[model samples]
Target chain A: MKLRALAHSRTGDKGNTSNISVIAFDPANYERLRREVTAERVKTYFAGIVKGDVVRYELPKVSALNFVMTETLGGGVTRSLALDMHGKSLSSALLDLDIPEGEE
Target chain B: MKTIRIGSGAGYSGDRIEPAVELAEKGEIDYLVFECLAERTIALAQQAKMKNPNAGFDPLLEPRMRAVLATCKAKGIKIVTNMGAANPLAGARKTAEIAKSLGLTGLKIAAVGGDDVIEAIRETPWPLVESGGSTTDLGNRIVSANAYVGTASLVEALASGADVVITGRAADPALFMAPLIHEFGWAMDDWDKLGKGTVVGHMLECAGQVTGGYFADPGVKDVENLARLGFPIGEVSEDGTLIVTKVPGSGGKVTAQTAKEQLLYELHDPKNYFQPDVVADFSEVEIEEIGPDRVRVTGGTGHPKTATLKVSVGYVDSYIGEGQISYAGPGAVARGKLALEIVKERLALMQVKTTELRFDLIGVDALHGPRLSAASEPYEVRARVTGRTDTLAEAVRIGNEVETLYTNGPAGGGGAFKSAREIVAVQSVLLPRDKVAGTVQIVEA
Candidate 1:
């Protein structure tokens, strides 16, 4: 199952770092997200765009996983030549990542 | 325990004023915060201030104040804003003048400043937060440097009997956190309480984001009345428990999902979310949908704050030149590609001194490149070329090359538009807390 099947995401940028949050639609799938949506997987997913490391922070209360990607965004918003300098569209792209469905 | 109600008026400089008016009139709030300054906004304002002595504040300040000042004054609801972009004194003076014209009496507006620490920063050799480059490297290109001050000065201003507080470059969450401190008398050193308050403030800082304004999708998320999306209001208690909601009759809803999305918006680390007052820890925070349009946020912790404050340093980075031309009907992708190729060749021939450039087909590969997009040709495409150059002449040439494509290449290319703009980029550096001092003075009309 795609990450979008169980979650919605939003992207924010500071300097060249892009922070994307993926929140589970249902808390039952939080464990599935925690298991499959690893930083390594996310780094591989955005292999070409993100130049540096990716770190994931977990929030079980909100059932959300925040992926902070360093050296992304083509540089910061004001300096970047990319069409979406802030990387706001990156969240939707991350939602396309596939994960195994968990039994309820 | 007593609780104070606070409303978020304007989220950004261009945010809608109608919702703010609704928040002031019907929200029954004690404080209304307007967060208008972006990272690079003040740098641009600094340029404007250089041109005109009294023109560095938010452009819509008067209009927004005109729309809400009367109701806010009548309801005894104080306002705190960072709309004083590059000039808080001028912003305070303008607010005072606006109040007098509106026949408002006893309206005390205060401006808190001393956040501009360019001179102080120049004395020290500090490395920037992102690039780790020395500050002296930028030299004459540096426009402004503002340290993100905390809520202490703002709290002092509120206590000094001011009805409105205008600030230049205080941290965003500090605006919301000040009211909680002022009303609850929460100790500045109380990390837990400050952390909880920061959570509420961060959630409301974006105004409509927490209230389902930006959470909508056509079918997947499905938020209603997003067109007239209502701003957020928080009922915060002395213990730092908060319930985020909106005006009852207003548009937009506050659900747990919305709260969760906002909770992590721009959040780098949940455990070490740094603010000037405290390094808040939202890792253990919890959100519960207590009622319709009411989400309860609690359980935020905090650690000791760093001795240094983060300063936003703005410099003249480059000039951005852009051009967009659309191609429709059959073979639009090929025409768009051809248009891009022509611009590339022209730019190389002209020897435009550009550091970087992008060629995007908007309908197809603007964002994802060709990797994610379909291999089949697109029926409609908009060819966009953006280049970054040091000189305006070089930048203009890049855009001019794209505009020339209408006649030179690519059949059916229409709606050719071009623009060249100076890019003011910003980076962060740490400055000792003692180097920057904040002062608050009430200006009366």
Candidate 2:
């Protein structure tokens, strides 16, 4: 079963934030979805997912890493709770990753 | 293995330090909470303030917190605490300073205030919740007060940025609940969900009390190796069901029955287990054993907050500075009482009037408290007495002459006079309608 990983990022002067999702089959391969997929992995990861800049914050004290995966989650501005195809695209990409199982 | 953690919530004294920490090393735990503020701490801190405003128990957190913080930080575990009494900002800063001193930066430090309005009583009117309590009748006797802030602050601290949240006054359940909220991102107004969260919080508030530290089933095997006992944890779900369990292969035992025993501990009524927001019906909170270590609990409710936030205030206060000349060789009790009588006569002759006069031998029934009352052995006793006076002159008269009993009264053990001076400080407590600020303006060292 696939779970949605929502990406949140800091944007603009006030540090406005955004979220995008990607399908994750397992937590292990989540690292490969982007170059340095971190609170800051958004800029590289969101290249095709969105058309904007991303700001990242590594707030480890809270054990959370935040990002600005802009244009990614915001393209569907007219609808609230809207699911953009960008996240769906990432999910589709993730759903196809071939698994080599040692089955540990 | 599923984890069960437990530790004393507020055995908040330096004396109770070793035992509380040793419970963990003797066992397994996902988390630990220490409740370090109680009426006695409030009283003690209040008295300390009179002598020197800031010269009080901040250091007390050192012994207990050091052991826990060092271990938890090293192991990447977490702690929720209210040892932040008097000044939490100071405590958090102190923690950060220690972290920096040890090259442990990025240690999330958060402080929750704005709930601690010491001056609230004089301004806003608190809508009466019950009739017998008019809140008005309480005149100056109110000293070293605090509001019951809930889990929201801890949740926010965990949300925004904090490896550790040092709070002033919050319900014990809040500490545990805040972590769950941070983990699940549970919304605040979700009463049913919050109810579920609170039930989990309630189960683990008392440390060892839940995990056989206070009570034991005679049938169970060795409870020794108590040095590292497992803490209790409630694996709660959104619907308010939880398993009260400890770490697998731990020092304590957990069963639906043992969990039930803990549920009854320190609580007045099972059906009416109360918190700030919920009149939690323990009857509603059901428990089941899913397996060896998991005792599941369910069915609880939460109400909207009556106050936006809670207020806790601490200030300088006075207490009966009492001491005794222990005359325990022989004829101790009788002579002690006689000496007390002489002090009374002397105070009366000297025109001394006080609010109260207490005379009782330490080993006798006059001494009452949670633990020491359990000591049944009789020993040489002091006729420890306290006389309150408005003026130090009058107070000094009683405090100064307490030693005269040695020469005049029939002495068994030699008597020595001790000081009886108390300091009283008043704090005006108020609940503000704002969340505490999480922004820390960094200072360049």
Candidate 3:
């Protein structure tokens, strides 16, 4: 199952860095999100677009995982020649991440 | 239970004006805060100021004030905004003039200054946070440098009995935080309260975003009546607790999902979301939907602020040339690819110099590259060619190549559009908090 089945995401950019937060649709899916969505996997998933390190911060109370990826936007919004300057669509792109189905 | 109801009027500089007017007339709020001014907005405003001294503020400032001022004044709802952009004094003066013209008397408009620190930045060498270079390297290219100021000056403006407060480059959340501080008498050192207030500000800063404007995903995360989406209003008590809601009978639903998505918008480290007032922590924030279109938010705390403040430095980066032409019917994808190839070869043959270039199919691979795009091809696609160049002449050539496709290269290519503009890039640097001062000047009508 895709991550979209269990969670939703939003992307925010500052300079060259982009932070994307993936929140579970149901509170019960929080543990699976934490276990499956690792920073290493996220960095590899956005290999071409993101050029720097990825840091993951967990917000258990909100059942969300925040991934901060550096050098994500071509440069920054102002300098980047990309069509989506703010990388706003990246959040939707991240929702396409595949999450293995677990026992219900 | 002394509580103040604050309405978030406008989210960004170009946000809708009617939503704000709705808040002013019907929201029943004490304060209406407009959190305008993005990272690059002030830098662009600076360029505007260079062209004309009196025209650096938000262009919609006049229209927005004209729309809501009389009603806000009648209801005794004070207005706060960073629409001052690059010139708060000019903004304040203009607001005073508007108020008087509207026959509203005894209104005090305060302009908060000291956010502009280009001269102070030039006096010393400050290291750039993004790119590993110093401010000295930017030299003459530096157009504007403004620090993310805290709630102090804004609070001061409110405390002085100002009816409207305007600023240029303040921290977005601080606009909402200032009223909380002034009304509740929350000390500047009260980190926990400031943190909780910051959460409210962050939630409300985006206006319609918290109310379901950006959360609509059609069938999956469906939001109703987005076209008439209402802005948010925060009901706050003296103890820093807040209930986020919208005016009754307004468009857009304020469910837990919408509030949750907004809570993480533009936030990196939930535990250390830095602001001028404090380092707010939202990791433990609880979002519970107490009633229809109402969410109770609590459990946000904060740590002491850092010694230095983040300054956004804007400079002339380069010129960008973008062109798009749509192709439809059968074999549109193939034709679009051919057009890109033709433009690529044409630019090379013409010896056009560009630092970066991209060929994208708008409906398909424009957003995410081809790697992530769907395998199946669409019946119609818009081909876009964009390039960044040092010179405007070189930049213009990129779009010219794409426009040439209408006649020279591809078949059925229509809606050819092109634009060439200079890019003003923004970077960050840290300066000692003491180096930048905050000042408030009041203008009365």
Candidate 4:
């Protein structure tokens, strides 16, 4: 079967740009979210593997901070094959970290 | 160089014509897309299900849809659509029935479900409607509850040999994007490529909107045969850029302004239009209507969403009826306004509330009433208010009191009133990516 038709799903690495519209219930949570999620960590972890710029966006309306990673997915969209990669592991990646509050 | 064609019809709020198909055949364009899904439409589909468990609202009713499907089948064209409202299985069965009726038996049909997490409202604890200043808990009151499942399922169904794939409720762009992924064989974790396809899907999701349905160009009126509108198609390459246009000779103009409007349909920021793929920047974009029926769109950044769930809810008319009132006189407009205002004050005193209220002042709002030979000097004002709330007694009571407005109004125009039945509410919960537990069914024919 073609990779596109495969049931396995992998929703990842929006290049170096990630639209993380996050929020926090309180300043403590905000600090926790900020401490836990940082551009440097994302950049350091995926810096070698992914290409492009990683930027962070913070909103007052959002209790959390957002990240926008640009041009990180293997020279933009044309050469992607991540659909075949099992996305089941994301549950673990997300479970460990806090997502704070999210908007849209 | 192939393209996919699709559209929306039936129970939707716009013209349900098949202008998309007509243009594709005329221009030999590959794909067509139609997008029409609102909170209200799913309600109609639910009501349809009440009468016939198997029958409900589907978009195939638009004249062009039938014409396009028939013509495409005859000419060996592959078509994809999301006409399925509530019961995709039933919808696909009906599509097959139509194909057989047309003697297009080679047609393959498939339905994608299990995206509905509505039943999980009890198991999962999602934020409520007020979380985003909108209601989120669409309990049993829900008229429809289909997840915005991605388009890969449709691709799977198509791969199963479906000449036409129908879906219940997948994200609009997913339908268009998955086809490209299937054709290209793009791999998982390829977020950039997926984003590219997503951008293409977003471009063609609304057929005319991308074309000229809402363009601002002043010189685009000369295209002939506009009565039949043309459908849109996106030629997406591996790199996340594409050319958006429709079938030639199709009604509507494709210009930069049109692209901006559609781009902003769900865009929050000019440079930060984030989807699953590229964090697209509207500011970083350039548009050139290089030739007829073609507009090349470029410059989109990529990003991911922080929140996993958005809320959607619906309503079902408990009871429905039509009633009208007319007014006449030189002071018709002034009096009508006063009458409605008075009715509102009275209803407030009576504690009457409803889900929706709309009033249309017909004769006065018409075009050049003074220029036409038709002179209905009678200052008649028609006010129609319809809504579905928790109770009908208060609604009827309010309706009765409003009728008395004609006697006491300053304009002295007589008033008429009637009460329709109330409708029920269907509520569901929106969950983040982790909580969805249903399994999808993909049958290959």
Candidate 5:
């Protein structure tokens, strides 16, 4: 199963840092997200794209995990040569993460 | 049980006006907030103001005000916005003139300013958070440096009997929180209430974002009538409880999922979401689907705020030169690749001093690149070449190199477009809160 099946995400950027929020569609999947979507796993998941450290913050009540990726926008919106200047599509990239079957 | 209904009118500067008009006319909101400024918008507006003293606010300011002013005034709904961009005083005066022109009299408009810290920055050049270098490193290229202020001045303006509040570079959440503070008389240091109010403000600040406009994914996260997506209206109580919903009969859904997604949008750390008024903590916040299109959000906690305020510093980063041309028919992919290679070699031959460059195939790997996009032959591909250079002349050559591909190489290439412009980059810095004092000026029509 892909993370997209169990979660929906939104990405926001400032300077060169991108903050991506992955919220579970079902509250039952929150624990799975907590276990699988570690900051290290997320950093490895976006290996080539994100250059800086990845920090994950847990919001148990909201069943969401916020992953903040630094130095990811190439050079931020104003300077980035990428088409998606704000890294808005990064959420889609993150949603493509694979989760084992029966995990959901 | 006293609740204040605040509606988000516009998210960004060029956001849709009709939705805002809908929010004003039908949403029955006490305050309509328009978060019209982005990080770099004010800097660009400063440049525009330098060129024309009268033209620094949002381009749609006049039209948006005209469209919503009468109805809002008639309904006794107050307006709060950072549409003032680089010049709040001018924006307020312009808005006042518009009200007078509309034959609406006795409209009180307040412009809160003193966010601009360029002079102070010049006196004591602080190091930017992005680059540890001092502001002096950017030299005269620096355009604008405005610190994000809080709800103090805005609350004062609202309390001064002003119907509309115009501001420059105030924190986005503050635009929504000011009315809450003023209405509920929330003590400025009341961290818990401020945190809860900030949560509501953050959710509604992006307008349609939380109401299914940005949440829609066909088949997966299905959202209804996204095109006519209704903006969000937050019903906040004196004790900081909030119910997020949209106007009845309007399009879009405001589910707990949407509210939860928005709760973390642009948020770095849920434990410490920094705002001038409070260090908001959303980690303990709860969202429940109390009803259809209504989510009850509560339990947002907070700590004392930091002494320094974040300042958005804008400077001339560099010049960007870009060119795009479409290649169609049998070997479009091959031709697009060849076009890109030719532009690359041509830029080298022309001695274009590029700091960084990107060559992309729009129909293929422009977005995710080869990582996500599987290599496939498309019938048509748009070849785009972009580069950043220190000088405008060098930047122009980058696009000129690509434009040369029109006659130099590639087959069936057409619809060529080229552009070169200076890149005004923005970064954040922290300045002592006491250094940048804010003031409110009221204009009556």
Candidate 6:
């Protein structure tokens, strides 16, 4: 199953860094997100697009995970020549992450 | 609990004016805030000021004031904004003129200045946060340097009985937080309250975003009436409790889902979201839907602020040249690829010197690149070629190469568009809190 089935995400950019938040639709699914969505996996998930390290911060109270990816945005909004300069669509791309079916 | 209602009018400079007018006329709010400055907006405004001294503020400031001033005044709703981009004094004067022209008297407009620290930056070089270089490296290329001043001067402006407060380069949350401090008499050193207030400000700073404006996902997360999406109003109490909602019968819904999405938007570390006022902690913040369109927020706290304030330094980075053309019908994907190849070859043939270049198919790989794009090809695709160059002449040739594809390369290509523009990039540095002073000047109508 895709992560989109259990969660939603939004992307925000500052300088060359991009912060993406993934929130669980059901609070019960938050633990599943925390267990499956590791920083190493996320960094690999965005292999070509994100050039630097990815750090994930868990918001347990809110049932969300904030991933701060550095050296993204193609050099920041003001200087990036990319069509989606702010990397706004990157959140939608992360929703395509595959989550394992069934319980662990 | 003595609660105050504050409406978020405009999120950015180009945000919709009608929603703000709606807030002023019928939102039944006491204070209305418009967070209009982006990272690079002030830098562009500085450029505009160089051309015309009186024209550094938000261009829509006049129209926005003209639309909401009378209504806001009639309802006794105080207006606060960073629409004063690079020049708040000029912004205040213009607002005063508009108020006087509208026959509204006894209106006090205050402008907070002293955020401009370019002179100080010139005097003593600060280490750049992103580039790991000193301010001296940029030298003459630097266009503007404005420190992110906090809520002190804004609180002072409100306390002076000013109906409207304008500032340049203020922290976005400070615009919303200042009112809470002034209305509730929250001490400047109250870290916990300031943190909660920062949460409220962060939620309301983007206006309609906390509503259903940006959270719509077809079939998955459905949002209704987005066309008439109403901006948010924070019902805040003295002790820093907040309920995020919208005007009754207005567009968009306020639920825990929307609140949670906004809570983490643009946030890096949830444990320490830094602001000029306080280092807020949203780690334990709670969101619950108390009513149909109200989400109660609590559990926000903060620590004392850092010794230094972040300053945004804007400089001429480079020039960007871009061109796009659409290809449709049977072999659109192949033709689009051919178009990109031709432009790449043409740029090389023309000896175009570019630091960076990109060839993208709009529908297929424009956003996520080819790795993540779908395997199947689309019937229609727009080929885009973009490059960054030191000189404007070199930048212009990148687009010229793409435009030639209409006649020289692709078949059935249409809608060729090209543009060349200078890039004003922003970097940050930290200035000691004591080095920057904020002062407010009031203008009466």
- Error (Å) of candidate 6 at residue B370 is 0.7
On the 0 to 100 scale, the lDDT of residue B9 in model 3 is 94
Cand 5, B chain, TM: 0.98
Best by lDDT: 6
> Residue B357 error for model 5, in Å?
1.2
Q: What does candidate 1's lDDT look like per residue over B316-424, in tens digits? A: 9889999999999988888899999999998899888889999999989888677766677777999999999998878888878988987898788899999898889
User: What TM-score would candidate 2 get against the native?
Assistant: 0.63
> Candidate 3 residues B209-300, lDDT tens each?
99998888877799888889999999998888889999888889998888888999899889999999999999999999999999999999
TM-score of chain A of each: 0.95, 0.39, 0.96, 0.52, 0.96, 0.97
Clashes of each: 0, 40, 0, 67, 0, 0
The DockQ figures for the candidates are 0.84, 0.01, 0.83, 0.02, 0.87, 0.93
True contacts kept of each: 0.82, 0.00, 0.83, 0.00, 0.90, 0.94
| Over 4 Å off, model 4 | A1-104, B1-14, B57-65, B129-140, B215-228, B270-283, B304-311, B315-329, B345-389, B400-430, B434-445
Chain B TM-score of candidate number 6? 0.99
Badly placed stretches (over 4 Å) of model 5 are: none
| lDDT tens digits by residue: candidate 6, B158-238 | 999999999999999999999999999999899999999999999999998899879999999999999899999999999
Error of 6 at B223 (Å): 0.9
- Residue B211, model 3: Cα distance from true site in angstroms: 0.4
DockQ: the better of candidates 2 and 4:
4
Q: lDDT: which is higher, 4 or 6?
A: 6
DockQ of 2: 0.01
**Runs in model 1 with CA error above 4 Å?**
A101-103
Worst 10 residues of 4 chain B by lDDT: B365-374
> Best candidate per DockQ, number?
6
Docking class of 4: incorrect
Tens-digit lDDT track of model 4 for B309-344: 433444442432223355676767667656666666
- The residue-level lDDT of candidate 2 at B132 comes to 29
Candidate 3 root-mean-square deviation in Å: 1.0
Q: lDDT for every model? A: 0.91, 0.51, 0.92, 0.51, 0.90, 0.94
